[model samples]
Target: MLSLSGLALFAGIASAYVVSNGTTCYLYPESQIHLGRNVDDTPSIHQAFDQCGTNGTVVFTEETFHLNTVVNTTGLLNCLVELKGELLFSTNVPYWLSHSISVGLQNQSTAWLFGGTNVTFLGQGGSINGNGQTWYDENQNHSNQPGRPITITFSNSTNLWIENLRIIQQQFWATFVTYSHNVTMKDVYVNGTSNSRWNTVNTDGSDTWNSRDILMENWTVVTGDDCIAAKGNTTNLHVKNVTCYGGAGMTIGSVGQYPNSPDYDENIVFEQVRTIDTFNGAYIKTWQGETAGVSSNGDAGGGGSGLIRNITFKDFDMINCSLPLQITQCIYTEDAGACETSKSRYIEDIHFENITATSRYNIAASL
Candidate 1:
């Protein structure tokens, strides 16, 4: 979290609705009249970004903004976003299914594609609500829905600072960072609990893929999926002071999916974390080699090569966790002997230190 005083990008650019301060420009959306309506704020947001997205600030001042369309605001330069309001997505299943932006990762899509250089976002108690109960009830079997958008995505960007942001009931993963670098998020909260009979599936708190130099701390995640997952080509990720509930704690991979593409993840660390009623405090799951298929849950993978190296999970407090630490190389494979016989992904220099876990099972870990 960076203060406005610390912003050093002094270049000035102003427009009709954009105002200029000492070194920072500001744009307050003029569409406050459309608050809480069926009207979309995506165009207003795009206008503000186009006007004051470079060396400036965009202030979301309304109490609530209803969005029913896709939002893609990227390539901003040295901007700060002040969120003093809520951004709520509509539950039009058919509309979103056709309009969500493709992320090019395992049939995933996103409601918003947000990224930029030197972008700093400070959410002053504001939130992004996905209104996921609709999706949950629609997809009753919890199967993967094509074009079900993640709440937000940071992609193809650099130098992002996001703080004090809350995401509730995301349609899919709360946040996904891909092909980005030098991203930091702190004091973030995520909740994806379902109030209906249908479960909230695939609602990962945060996931990173093809990214580097990421730092996440002081996050509280309540979801049905991974709290934080590092997918293929993730490097130098350090997550600390995280508290997870009812999720797959901290995870590395389900990688090694593409047979031709090599998965390389290295220098990952998750320290001082707390998991309650989670599947595992920390785990690494890689697909078995010489195999390819999709699972019942619609996760398609297998037959890939890779190396996971220099990973550490330290100082974890796991309460009633199934496995404190797990390394499964044969995930998604039915053959028990295939884990040993198959040419699987390689793991080296892995360490689990100072773990205090009370597993429901007798075995503390499985490797």
Candidate 2:
């Protein structure tokens, strides 16, 4: 149920300090901020999480920390951030389209709404930099541009621990976890590239909605979209040794899209994956209950129902991937006989074990 407007957007308190016990707040970067002139270290990083954020330890030793405002810093507990510096964000985009921070999903937005509990984000080799080439040249026609933020959001809170992070140029979807549970993202290092042909579209590399016991391992994504996405009410998700170059692989659900809302993805798992040119090394997308609209990345939805059960895609290794296995209940349907006469939203125990693929096309499993 989460979503009391996503817990009131992670509450308040932007300044104050006192709590101690191994405390260690050491941030700094607004002495007339440098490197292309940027300032506003977001209120001294919310006053260093109001000084050591609880059980203490918030060191971001400034190599660059611009962030033109908005960084919720929710109810932290046994906190510790130590990202040796480099946050950056801020191509301004209309003051982040009037101050970002919306976790209600789909109409996504976030410039960091990081939550509470036993949190720990240690990017020893720090980096966030969502300078996303001016939102990929103003979303070069891939639409869905409502204040494009999503470069940091691990909502509500739990026993979270994001390690060795380095999500680059991401103006959208580089990490989004909702409500939160025992989250654990390891050695992350995403790179949503684009040198002005304008197509770092939807750059997803770690996405989970409504969340549960999540755990993404040793990632190394170079995105375009979904290197990892278990959307909808995702439950015990666990992705292992990931490595995708071009995205859209290892996904589950564009999801049952809101026909009176009832979607629940269960025990999901993608293990030891590796896709190079990717389009799909393992993907699944639903949407065709009573139909709906908008999705060429504009992301609207359909008549969602629910239940995508115990899923698993193990040991995949696709090189020239185009579709090493894909599923679609006719997402955003354009009359495939009216999406085969509608009503489809319960994908059961899906599993694909030692899959080894090499395809650029010529149909490699597309259902």
- Whole-model Cα lDDT per candidate? 0.85, 0.82
In candidate 1, where is summed lDDT lowest over 10 consecutive residues? 8-17
Writing each residue's lDDT as its tens digit, candidate 1 over 20-129 gives: 55444454433433343366667767877886788888887645777778998899999999888789899999999999999988888999999999999899878899
Clashes of each: 0, 0
RMSD of 2: 18.3
Candidate 2: tens digits of C-alpha lDDT, residues 1-367: 7688544432321122112234776676764324446667778788778877899888877477778888889998998888887888878888887789888876888888888999899898779889888988887837558878888888888999988899898888888889899999888988989987778878888788888998889899999878888889999999999899997889997787777778899999899989899888899987776655665547767777888898999999999998889888776767667466446567888999999999997999976
**TM-score of every model?**
0.90, 0.34
Give lDDT: candidate 2, residue 149.
84
